[model samples]
Target: MKKLALLLAFPLVCYGLTIDEAVEKAVENNLQIKQQEMEIEKSRYQLEQDKNLFMPEFFMDFSYTTMKDTPYTKLPAGSLPFPLSFKQTNKDFRFFDFGINYYIFTGFARIEKIKISKLDIKANRLMLQEQVNTVSAKTKKAYLDVLMARAVVDVYRKQLEAVQKHLERVKEFYKQGLVARIEILQTKVKLSEIQRNLRKAEGELKIAKAVLQNVMNVNESLEVEPVKISLPDTLNIEELYTRALSNRSVIYSLKERVKQINSLEKIELSQFYPKVAAQLKYFYTDQYPYLDPKENYALVLGLQWKFQGAAPYYGYLKRKTENSKLRLRLQEIKNDIKLEVKAAYERFLTAKANLNVAESSLAEAEEYYRMVVEQFKNQLASTTDVLDAESMLTSARKGREISYYQLLKAYVDLEKAVGGSLKDEK
Candidate 1:
């Protein structure tokens, strides 16, 4: 019968919402998600920058000047003759040059660096997804809190009304000399206390609204109503745990980090190999031969082998060690995630059980309060008994409200811990 009663009451209190609509709206308005998106864009740009390193670079230069008091030139016979008339600061010398440099090979260093940058971009994308998930969860939790606070205010108002009615009955009995004047005064005092508490609840509801507004990035003038959320009958904790390990953004990011580290180590090793490059230059000069140096087109092929006294080998070994450390850290992170998933699953079960208990207690307290009111009206119970029952009823109402929101939050936390959605059980 109690279950039937609650079922009947549910319709009057049930809210309306669709999951897609809520998520879409939150994504559009959430500032943190937008910021994360910007970070992803930055990473993409960095990838582009790294990719450009393999392309040829072209440049052009032009200069005009005259010099005086310069050193003498040697004749074709290799004997220095009289000093040439030269400008110290060149007054009539002009030339133009164009060139392109192409690195044919650099120990595969650039290629590996680009690979590392690409991996970093992938990691950044995963981080962005995590940010979106975290912010949405926070917004949903705040929304639920506002709903619970509103429900609490309703409970307090009803309790206050019940107290007022009981006080009136006590006053009437006292006027008829059936109850002591002290009893009537005590009833009045209790009524005042209830009112005070109700007012406090009302203020709390307002604060909850403000917090919701801040999170949703909504206007204060926009009102929000509780939307009904249906719960699943049961959960498969193991499946959720599996999904979390595979889908969690943090884990994916760590995997990408490992790839990036490996790429970096390859790049470091590349430094020990030789680099080959090709260069071409074209120049034009307009001044007299005596005033401006001659210019011509030229092509050059080059190879560079830098041993740096075996410094590069030391650097390569250090990078390999760093990569090893990164791998260990990633393993540690995976272990931590496993523990988190286990804890979150347990918390969800606890919250579910608590919701059930709170529901049962709320029903029992409401029934007790109703019976006590009837007893007082029939002159068989005292005002204290009525007050005590009302207080119990208030406690039960608050407990149920709190537990419902807590369960909702716990459900969200579990989903986040697993890196995906846990749709209400069927």
Candidate 2:
């Protein structure tokens, strides 16, 4: 009865952290997210490169040359003595050429390329979103782990206190000749055992904190304290699963890939058509047995046509059109995600059931401990019986604590599988 009163009087301390703060810290610190951000920047640059493809290209060339020996060379009619209009000549010459070229048309291929690049950029953005989902899940799981570890340590501490107090009472009773010395020694041993268990739990708590720190991008050696486990009463697995499928980053990325492939297919199809381009050239030459340099500056226009029979163009079109394979793969991924969501949801339900059982067992164990302690004080129960009750009560408390944490973790996994953060859902 006295032991029960003491146990009831033990206060539960709530310590350290909020869920939102933990998530914010993780987002700021996670290395993987930073890498994804870089990829987004890269994609932006690629989009810019695609835009530049439409602009004109400017080029210039200069040459200075000397021919050491004279030889016959080609010349215009009546310009040379030989009947054949040819010469091997030695000469010194300087020349420069400058030109600008722009594609006036590419059968709409340039337009398609721009579209493809835009799609790629969109895909990269979706990739970042996927990374966000993954990181958020990992961070929340790690945070819950720390909370569970802390809860376990607290439970152990409570057991240790109970056992230590029992040992003190046994010692006092022994000194008063009310109990055997063996009883006092046995209680002392039990107290020491509980202390050892407490220390082990504390060690695990430290390891859990380290894992949380890693997820949050904190220095590995830095300490972190997470929120107390105040299990939410109004849990909804169905709603969470729905949110996950809709908000998951991986799904969004896959959708982007599909769009990108669609654009690629369109660009490939454009290869079968003719292209048109505009050209202009400027040139100067000296000492050439040829037309005047001013004559080389004439404007030019060009056209390029791909024969329908061209192997490479058809090959590209064939390849891109076959991307239904990728679409089917995406569909398969969606099915797999559905199964994963189902499994996680089931796990959460099972854990919740088990927790309820554990809670009931804890209540029974506490009552049993209270009754046995009273009987022992009245000299109606043996020391072994009292010890057994203490053991039962401690075991029940520990089991309940473990089950609560496990249930909490199962909930966390379900959230991850669904791809939505619980906080965000709320």
Candidate 3:
């Protein structure tokens, strides 16, 4: 009969959502996921631009110059035995040049550049994966929180109804002169207290719902029934530690950063070597209308070896140092995750034990309440004793829900520590 009453008390909410469905919706609509995807495309475009460095590049040039005065190379008055005549030209000059250069070598710098861009794309992909896991974990927790709050409301309402029935019994006893009038007054006070508590629980339920909706990025208020997610059947902390070390996306992305550093170091080393290039050029010049030169073209070979200050060498060494630090940091992350798995496993076990105790205590409290009520009806027990029994029962039930919800949250944390979704947890 209690079960039927609990069922009838539940509001028939229209929407029902599983945790997995919520995770899917969060990932699909999440802005960070879109940004990471765009970064991948940006890397690809950068790769194309780097490759274009080796392709033929064309350019054109035009220039005009004017001096205020005509100038001539004048001989000293008696510097040479032969007679000299001074010549002056107009102070205007114009020219045009066109060329194409094909850069063929950069001490393998081009090859390393391509590799770095590719690694960037891979890193961005890992970033997307990490975002998905993070969002999914949050969604799972929030979704379960709504359910936990709902359960608390339900528990409070049921207990409130039971206390109301007790209040009526006490009133009847007072009318029969079997109980003092103070007993009826005490019962009414308890009823009012439970009603206030029930209101708080209902308000909490609404807040939990709002929190879940906010996570899902929905504007409309939803009436969702969260499907219960069961705890894992078995937990192996050591196994989870090993899996997290191997499968965590954060570690993978850091490893990719290490790869990028290595590629950069190689490219920096390539800068010290000589580079060869081939070029083709054409030009035309006209000092005056009657002195136009023919269209001229040339094929040229080029070699370059430039010296850099000590800063570049220092940068190369810095790259090496950065890679070393990242490797150590990755190892540190693994240690941290191992510690998390251990701690979460312990909390889960504790919550599980507490839940068991709460369930047993609830049964005892209910039996005691029944016996106390019967004694009160028979004029053998005081009304205060019956009220105390009912209070104990309510406390036991409330404790049970608290423990159960704590276990739920701990289980979610455990899954996160293992670096995966609850459904696929090992």
**Candidates 2 and 3, the one with greater TM-score:** 3
lDDT of each: 0.78, 0.75, 0.81
Ranking by lDDT: 3, 1, 2
Using TM-score as the measure, name the better of candidate 1 and candidate 3. Answer: 3
Residue pairs in collision within model 2: 71-88, 71-89, 72-87, 72-88, 73-86, 73-87, 73-88, 74-87, 130-249, 244-418
Candidate 1 to truth, TM: 0.85
- For lDDT, candidate 2 versus 3, the one ahead is 3
Residues 1-426 of candidate 2: C-alpha lDDT, one tens digit per residue: 999987877754444566667778888888988988888888888889889889998888998888875456455657556556454432776778889888887767677777777777777777777777677767777777777777778887887777777777777777888888888778777778888888998899898878888888786344346544444455565676667668766777777677777666667767777788777878877746554443377577888886656664666667576567777877787777778888887887888999899999999999999998888777777678888898888788878877887887777777668775465444
> Which candidate achieves the best lDDT against the true structure?
3
TM-score of each: 0.85, 0.85, 0.88
For candidate 1, which ten residues in a row score worst on lDDT? 82-91
How much is 94 displaced in model 3, in angstroms?
Answer: 2.3
- For this target, which candidate reaches the highest TM-score against the unseen true structure? 3
Across residues 6-70, which tens digit of lDDT does each residue of candidate 1 receive?
99998677444344445566777888878878877888888899888988999899887766544
